[model samples]
Target: MASGLFHLAVFAVDGGPWEGPVSWRKAVTFGLSFGLTLITIAWVSSFVALGDRARNVLLGVFAADCVLEVALITVQAWRRVPSHFNMETALDTTISRMLAVGGGVLIVVLVTLTVAAFRDGAPGAAPDVALSMRLAVRAGFVALCGALLSGAAMIARGVAEVQTGHQQAAYHVAGALKPAHAVTMHAILVLPALAWLLTFTRFSEARRVRVVAVVSAAYGAAAVVVIGVSAIRFATA
Candidate 1:
């Protein structure tokens, strides 16, 4: 699923008016729409701050990016105008609508929690409160990581396509690393996330700060390890 999306981006990036039956606006919309979608996920995942204020800041960033992506998609739809007469175009419209609906769901959850934090803003009154805070933080963090990994993987495939030219890039791994490297980086999000789960599993709200801290730190480190390797290649390049 991911690899297909990556190549689709490449197809759109290099496409334009010259490509008969293809809308330049649609191509750009597709790339930016999906691109921002991935970043929204990453920004939240990487935020290590457990404080209420920190979570709010991350949520704000994600929301803003999502709005930008949606606006672009709307403009594209306006210009191209969906074909009521065509089955495929209707499918595209349906899929895009689904994406927006999903975004709305995230916003609702985000706002609910954010509002609660504002009303309940105070230092932990009990161990359970502290535990709940850490759990929310870790869950958000993992989600952000997944979003980023997907975006990077997509970008890397785009690069590979550019290097290999159309057909070759479509089928083979591109640029600095093999396809497996990209897969590994993305799949690693599960590791630290599992650690976090183990630390807080079904326990009552009364939680130990030290244990939560240890788990979150481990999760952060796991994310860093994947990022660090990707960074090394970028720096050398």
Candidate 2:
């Protein structure tokens, strides 16, 4: 999943700030998408009354975000297929709208849950345990779908962007498109982590396994920390 997300974020990153419509659109889309996401995460971390549940639910929360975003984008795609088949602008708008909805969902879920957490844990009557459970469940489902769909979108974009970037200019304008490039590199590590988690390996060399374990944990932890920071930001904001 992380591999897919990394590719998604980086695919078209080779384009400079002044590329064609697709490139320009991608830049704007990613700028707002990624920027706002980071902000949300930061806020949540800073202000949310995160408890053991929130602190330990990293994978679940991320999954919810991915699900929400992907569902929105898919809806937009379904809408644009007929009338706006030939209209690139319409298609772009659809994608943007989907992303916006996804962002909105993230904000809502994080903020609401965090707020509830504050209320539940604060000095008051017994916290609404049942309600909290329901919310957490809902959040997890949203995160799962959101992560999968958004990851796919990002992977497709990354592949396209990288190809286009190579054709447009050889390492000339990797700055403006840095996000794509960064995600592509990130895929290398993330894919390995997924493999480690999802697949069984018969390794003759114990050292290799150890190395993989160490490196993957380090990389994954670092990425989670970054995401955690973003979550904190969202809570506060």
Candidate maximizing lDDT: 1
User: What stretches of model 2 exceed 4 Å from their correct place?
Assistant: 1-21, 24-47, 54-59, 62-97, 113-237
Candidates in order have lDDT scores of 0.44, 0.41
Candidate 1 wrongly placed segments (more than 4 Å):
1-130, 133-139, 142-146, 149-153, 156-160, 163-207, 234-237
Clashes within 3 Å, all models in order:
8, 43
Q: Write the per-residue lDDT of candidate 1 for residues 1-237, one digit (tens) a residue.
A: 233355356556765452222344444444554454445344333323235565566566656655554454444444554311112455655644555454455555444443433343344212243443445454444434444444445344544554454533422332333222343333224433443465557654445445555555665566567656655554454
Instruction: Write model 2 residue lDDT over 177-233, tens digit each, in one string.
Output: 333323322333243333334325454345444554555456545545654554354
Please report the candidate that would top TM-score against the real structure.
1
Residue 186 in candidate 1 has what lDDT? Answer: 33
Per-residue lDDT for 114 in model 2? 39
- Each candidate structure's TM-score, on Cα atoms with residue i matched to residue i, is 0.33, 0.28
